[model samples]
Target: MSIVDKVRELCGTKKITIAELERSLGLGAGTVSRWDTRIPGIDKVQKVADYFQVSTDYLLGRTETPYYALTEKDEPSIQADLERLIEDLDGLKYSKETEEFSEETKELLIASLEQAVRIAKMEAKRKYTPKKYRGES
Candidate 1:
């Protein structure tokens, strides 16, 4: 969907007109409607996003999720799981004289694992959380 369409949808949920939204954000009249034909500045988009409590990516149609809660990278349970998985990998012997994962390879694996875990946590929260609790209308 276009940015204008998304804005319109959000406005409808809030029972506010586009003009009201513009005025509330201190934007000029018809500025948001004009986004249908003109590319709006990032600052304007960010302002609208902040007002709506949604991500700029959602307003820009880059993502379907509107509100993505922050994930804790240092969650004790997740970190413990990561460590256990790494230990399991280390326990596997590729060969008597060869290491299964070099230092650089281990670093890369850890980074990838952390990223995957973060995404998984976000998706789980988004999927399982109720719409009212998630701030969705």
Candidate 2:
């Protein structure tokens, strides 16, 4: 849906008309309606979103859900997992591999390992996020 549609829907929920919304926003009549053909600035978009108590992305129709409360603990939890995995992998016998792996190759391998761990964490969260109190971004 367009910004106009979102605003209209919000107006309905709030029991207000487009003109009333514009007036409430200190915008001239038809200002909000004109947004259908003309994209407004970030400031205006934020204003409207704030007024309606919705995210700008939601008003812009970027997402179906208006809110996604992420878990505040996810970051630290993921970090802890990564640290443990890295510590475990550090003890692995890389002598044979290191003989062939140049300094550059070693760095690349380390980076790749870190990235894989991050991806794994993300996948786990995406597939099995059951905590309503805390969500991962």
Candidate 3:
């Protein structure tokens, strides 16, 4: 099915008309319905995805699922947590008095950053991936 059709299906399921969707999205009339002839810009596509709690890939027909399973942290919260993690890893506590850092210190810092990033990725995947799909993605 076309992305337009998928969108129409969601509209029906939600009991909203295309005009209502456009009004909610602040888009011009027939904006979404035009997907048949043209792909929307990234911003517009994201608006639709966010509205439906689905992924952009799903709207593009790349995935059968509408959205990833919700985790404890949504996107905004996850970003905030990641920022905090980065700050913890590179905060002034790690700053040496001397301008130059020893090779060992550099390696340790790099390793710590790598491990933190890996853990974050794994946690995210575990939370968002459907239970049955697991590590497939």
Choose the strongest candidate by TM-score: 1
Q: Of models 1 and 2, which has the larger lDDT?
A: 1
lDDT of 1 by residue, 44-107 (tens): 9989987877777888877786765544543876678677777876666454667566678778
* Every candidate's lDDT: 0.78, 0.70, 0.70
Q: Can you list the residue pairs that collide in candidate 3? A: none
TM-score for candidate 2, residues paired by index: 0.49
lDDT of 1: 0.78
What's the distance in Å from true for residue 49, model 3?
A: 0.6
C-alpha TM-scores of all predictions: 0.51, 0.49, 0.50
- Candidate 1 clashing pairs? none
By TM-score, highest first, what's the ranking?
1, 3, 2
Clash counts per candidate, in order, are 0, 3, 0
Ten contiguous residues with the weakest lDDT in model 3: 128-137
Model 2: residues with Cα > 4 Å off, grouped in runs: 68-137
True lDDT of residue 112, candidate 1: 89
